[model samples]
Target chain A: MAQVINKRIILKNYVNGFPKESDMLLNASATIRLNLPEASNAVLVKNLYLSCDPYMQFRMRESKAGSFTPGSPIQGFGVAKVLDSRHSNFKKGDFVWGLTGWEEYSVINTVGFLFKIEHTDVPLSYYTGILGMQGITAYAGFNVICAPKKGEYVFVSAAAGAVGQLVGQFAKLSGCYVVGSAGSKEKVDMLKNKCGFDEAFNYKEEQDLDAALKRYFPNGIDIFFDNVGGKMLEAVLLNMRFSGRITACGMISQYNLEQEEGVRNLYQIIVKGVQIQGLIANNYLHMFPKYMEMIIPLIKQGKICYMEDIAEGLESAPAALVGLFSGRNVGKQVVAVARE
Target chain B: MAQVINKRIILKNYVNGFPKESDMLLNASATIRLNLPEASNAVLVKNLYLSCDPYMQFRMRESKAGSFTPGSPIQGFGVAKVLDSRHSNFKKGDFVWGLTGWEEYSVINTVGFLFKIEHTDVPLSYYTGILGMQGITAYAGFNVICAPKKGEYVFVSAAAGAVGQLVGQFAKLSGCYVVGSAGSKEKVDMLKNKCGFDEAFNYKEEQDLDAALKRYFPNGIDIFFDNVGGKMLEAVLLNMRFSGRITACGMISQYNLEQEEGVRNLYQIIVKGVQIQGLIANNYLHMFPKYMEMIIPLIKQGKICYMEDIAEGLESAPAALVGLFSGRNVGKQVVAVARE
Candidate 1:
């Protein structure tokens, strides 16, 4: 085994709009020894699941402060097994999830971000979606952003994706009439049956989104977790209840559009007296432990269903990422960069 | 004077698209009883000066729930002397300003709306702006919506208008380096001199708005009070700091346009972590007295300069309102419907 072997996934070039497989390349050499000195104050971990998010598309671009450095392996949230540690807080054989490098072996200098996984009895892969950033995002956005009432009409877009699926379920448990929009019929069914959404729609077949929203939510949307912005958001604006709240967590639909789609019916926000705000999971990290406490029981009782589309081995990482933009993955798109 | 007179103004077939003076007809000989029963809780007042705003243009068109009913005299904020009072809250010789109908005399049923003027030491016209909806709006939206911190970059669109002018001054007093956009160089001058804006620009002359904002706010925008929300909004979106707040009080530029102008950079909101919120001043009615306490002193000390373009007579009301679309008014556009 080589002492300094690097398994890297480099961004091919600056992505303009929608990213393709051509934008990423996996460069690997061999295995490496995992060791850290007492003074190192660092942890050596074996990478497990690497999250493939649409926001990564932003990192792949060339900018003064792009999310990640181009021509380098993109690093993001992932689950890992600690191989060796000199940090007082971490120990060998401990499982963790945080900002791990997108490689087989990583030397994490900061342990402040990493959190030890206590409930390993559940699916370890759940850290990639339901038990991780996605879950926290959905929770904080729903509870904090909207202060959703029990009988509120909840609508989630990109409803089959990592965050959307959980939001729909949370809304259901809170007694909301939940409706979600997905790209495929299969995803829509998963939302209705598995995610416990009251109603689901395949937005692709929706002739007019305003009319579709009206038919699904005859009254109006009270809590809108806006994952996809553009025409859908414009339509949702028209269908919002008085004093409605729109939590803009992400806008996957508009992420790659060269020209932003125009929202014609935004004036409704004025008359409807709606409040729209954006949310980031990072800012709400203080609520993570409480989130797990709240979510673990739901998972054990099968009240909150978790989903993932896992690609095996580091070699499949590039294809797995590109598949996200094309909606090739069924649920939480992830790659097993390494096996413990 | 003919009884049952029609000093009323007609909506004139919804004005089709942009409003014109011809769209409204004001007939005289309209009169109503100067008194109501004590239990009626209504007050009869002679309208002295009515505030003409662009938002009233929205009420001109037939809308869902008949927001601005057609064939009705345009209604807005006004300074009125109480001729007779049936409500304990009001008395004869007292002045008030709230939602007064645009006519010579109004029998306002002070059931839920209407606030009596407690101070007449300042201009009675101040009831239409500095002490009325305009002032409270400026307070809540800028103070609460933007939640601005000292030294942060603030950008105000339509900065010479009723609300924007006050917001800019408040931001400056809060130690923010404020930059405001108006339609003319004269209006721009008013912002720098009267409003104490750090920088001002006539957006119409700027070939590149993004560049203009960058030049004025080199550090990037922390707060944006968006009164004109079309191209200026898109430009501000590009220049926003992370966690920036935008208070969307009005979008006068896009209000009357047959088609809403397309925003090509809304996705920047997600990337920059900006929050754009629509605000209705009435939601913060509980904070109105607090608003008066804060602003009355500023007005008395002459530290804050308020601007108004007064159009004489009720007959000129229609033109004064239509003038807003073309930026014809130099300051807060208003019409003196009558004089005591």
Candidate 2:
């Protein structure tokens, strides 16, 4: 066997407030053999790309869901090439995207959230977002929960975020009049221009979200795909028509706070007959095969598009993640650790 | 044709605050003919029982959903016997339940929210409640929206209100461990004895609702059918477990206030994966037939229960409605204008 090498980023401490660089630590871990042991259901693989998601911050905290152990390496989604495998579903040369450690190499136990990339005609990096967990979140939330109908009024918050952008596009494709909100002027323009939202607004510039939403949706929102919940959510609640639906995917605004913002108008939910649902993408992995069928064709046909902000090496991973909170990353923040 | 009679109650003016006796004026005006023109699709009926709901107060004020015309008799749910009809659905002696004038007799348009009373074996007053909108509201909100499961911790606020009492019983029948909160000691006792809540509390005595809820639900709430919103709903949001669902049927606490109370811990909806849905009974009319099928058996078997705070005469309707704001009424507050 050749000399083994592994470089991993471990969660240094359980984060108390908003995560900081001090919350994580980079360490050189003992390497594993590039060959799998007999009868072991493990895949020895070289990670080609890793995804940086906001939900990862939750794993850094010591909560009910599996947390990153104080001294263990952080885990996330990644695209990798199998160097050796003992699982029947995968071969040594197979390109896969699943749960892998944040390192140069990984020995993935065949347990949870693993998928082999079947159709590789498109960019393999697409698996990180538009064809993966994030993609299914938009599809399931929009199609199943929201049930967006033709000519319905749809609003998407965090319109420039990975999931929001796709949700807007999908709503538009479904014949909805879609609008979105973002934190940046550039994102607003990008949403209206490239993402094809009927209208887009920079939340930073709007003094009142209710007025902002009203200006865009004159008839009021029938569906709201919420990502940055807080005042935006309160305002959306006020403007929902009779029988509106809100898909609560993430609340990036309150994740790191010692205290979060209060919603002043939830009574409007009762008065307006609204349905707000919370969803976790991990719970939606079973829809992957159907999701690929819908999204892949959309990407190939250029009916749907996603912009990715690709960082070049392992060192840039921290900045990419932290940048999400600061509105620094333009689109999906992904790290390209190595080229296949 | 027999001499027409129309005993009516008209709003004296739009109530600026909680309704009072001075806000309404009752008149035993000349009643109208029961027979509609043969060419018309209208049903002329003699009003037997009228429903008094909190939402009717909104119709008293001017807004988007237009207020009832000032001099016209107040409109509400009623059980009536069709004296004459041009409508295909109604004929002489047919008992029906629908939106009719809040008086002795009414000429109802055939278009919306009218149903033939198929089963009259039980007390006809039940159609004003368990067989009517009140029962349907509880059935759709708790069973369908909240999706309560056996052994799930279910909490209901305003648990002695018209809809809430039934929702609590529905949760109990579902094998859920149900807890209900009422404003008075009498109501707390009634919630346990009459409504069959697994546990009951007087929210008026509890200094901290979150703590009270925690004491009742140590494992945390798996479902909350929120009838009283504002601060109590906020507390419920904080205590919800992962995948918990809240079906919001009303927010009585905030209804009459000039400014609604704000919710302080809404961020928990995303973190705990709780779903808060606001529902209107009107949209679920398609399920009404099925709703009756489930409710009738429950009522017949003594597996379900309800309560009513009946005002003796139409002159007392205004006082009963205003009493809802102050938690004066036990169970549903309905007025009996006439016996037949």
Candidate 3:
């Protein structure tokens, strides 16, 4: 048996509110055995890219069911290559993406969740975003939940981020008039130019979100792909058209708050006969094969585009993850743990 | 042609917030011609039962659409008898139910919305409730929006009121464990004993609505027929089960408030993967024929029961309508303006 150095990011404590970089610790001194245990079904893999998602913020809190324990390596979605495998489904040379540890190498006992990479012609880092959970989230939220019709008005918040950018593009492909809102001017430009949205705005600059929504969606919003869920959601509720659909994918704005902002205009949902539904990507995993079948060709044809804000090493993971809340990332934020 | 003195309840001014008896005037000096005009497709009717519904509160305010004009007669759903007719669908001596004025006699020009009563075996006042808009509201909200399954947990707020009482019975008929919340002890008792709810609670007595909900529904609410939308709605959001459905019928609690209460726990809708939908009975009018077919049998067989708090004469119409805000009426409130 041989020993190898493993760099990891560990949780310092159960997070109370907005997570700071100091709440996580970076350790390069930990060591792991290169050899696997006999008769075990685990696979040992070297992580290449780790995804920073808003839902991961919930895992840092003190929840009885799914929260990350203090002093443990924070777990998230990542792209990895198997170094060794005792599982029949995976091999030493197989590249995969799934739930993995925030370290250089992880012994993954969770065999069912791991998916072996089939298409490698595109960027391998995309396995963390476009080919993984984020892709399926955009697919299910827009296509399945919203069920948008052509020429409908579609609005997306956090529209420059991973799932939102794709949702805007999908809306356009469906012949919908799509508008998106981002935090910065650069991100807003990226939304309109790169993501193919009909219009985009810097929500941070708008003093009155209701007036902003009215200006953009003069006809009223038919489908709202909501990522942020505070005052923005409240404003969107007022401007929604009759029989509108709202896909409540993530409430990134409320996740870090001590007390979430109260939404006042929910009464409007009744007057308009709207349907607001919540969705989780994990529940729609069965649709991944269908999603890849639809999305892979779009990516190959340049009809779909994706962007990643990559940090250099495992040491940059804490800052990269924390940046998501403040809208520092231009697109999907990922940490490059190692190069193949 | 003879002239008749028709007493009416007229709006004194455009109401801003909670309505008072003084906001409406009892006009007994107004007179109408007993004869219909030649070549006019209108029916002159004597109002028998004027339904006092919660939605009428919105009409008292100054709105661009649907609000009552100052110095005009208050409009509402009512059961009436045709004293004279120039319309082919209705003739003299025909009993009908539709939108009519809150007066002793009204010349109805809109015949399309009016339905001629076919079953006179039941009380004519039943046309104001179980056989009319309120019946269809409960049918559409519970059966259409909620789409509940057997053995599921169902919750109704304002549970002894017009639509709420019917919704509880419908949920029970669907083999669900139904719980209802009312403002008073008598109403709570009526929900459990008369409406056949599995359990009932006086919301005024329960300081912690969430805890009360937890006590009744240890599993979690599968369907929530929301009538009181302020704090009760906020509490129900926390106790909903995964993929639960909520029918946003009426927000009686919020209607009279100058500034409606803000709902804080809406984030729970996302965590539970619930669907909250708004409904208007008018949109589902096509389903009316089918609704009556289903409900008439239930009413005939004594499987369905209804209660009405009837006020004597047109003089009490203002107080009866205003009483709905304070939960003063025990059941479906109606004003007996005249005998058919």
In terms of lDDT, the poorest run of 10 residues in model 2 chain A is: A23-32
Clashing pairs in 1: none
Worst 10 residues of 3 chain A by lDDT: A252-261
* TM-score for each candidate, following the candidate numbering: 0.94, 0.91, 0.97
DockQ of each: 0.54, 0.66, 0.79
Off by over 4 Å in 3: none
What is candidate 3's lDDT per residue for A177-197, written digit by digit as tens?
Answer: 999999999999898788889
Q: On residues B1-340, what C-alpha lDDT tens digit does candidate 1 reach at each position?
A: 2344436555655755568988888867566655666578788888899887777766666776535666667778889999888888888998888888888888887536777888888988878887888888899999987888888998899999999999999998899989889999999999888779988999989999999888888889999998988888888888988889888888887876778876767677666667777888888889987888888898899888999899998888888888988999988887886766
Predicted model with the maximum DockQ: 3
Q: Which candidate number has the best TM-score?
A: 3
Q: Fraction of native contacts in model 3? A: 0.80
Q: Give me the overall lDDT of model 2.
A: 0.84
Candidate 1 Cα RMSD (Å): 2.6
A271-314 per-residue lDDT for model 1 (tens digits): 67787777877787788888888999988987778888999987
Using DockQ as the yardstick, the better of models 1 and 2 is: 2
Q: How would you encode candidate 2's per-residue C-alpha lDDT over A30-92 as one tens digit per residue?
A: 676778779799888898888989888878888887788887777899898889888878898
Q: Which of candidates 2 and 3 reaches a greater DockQ?
A: 3
Number of the top lDDT candidate? 3
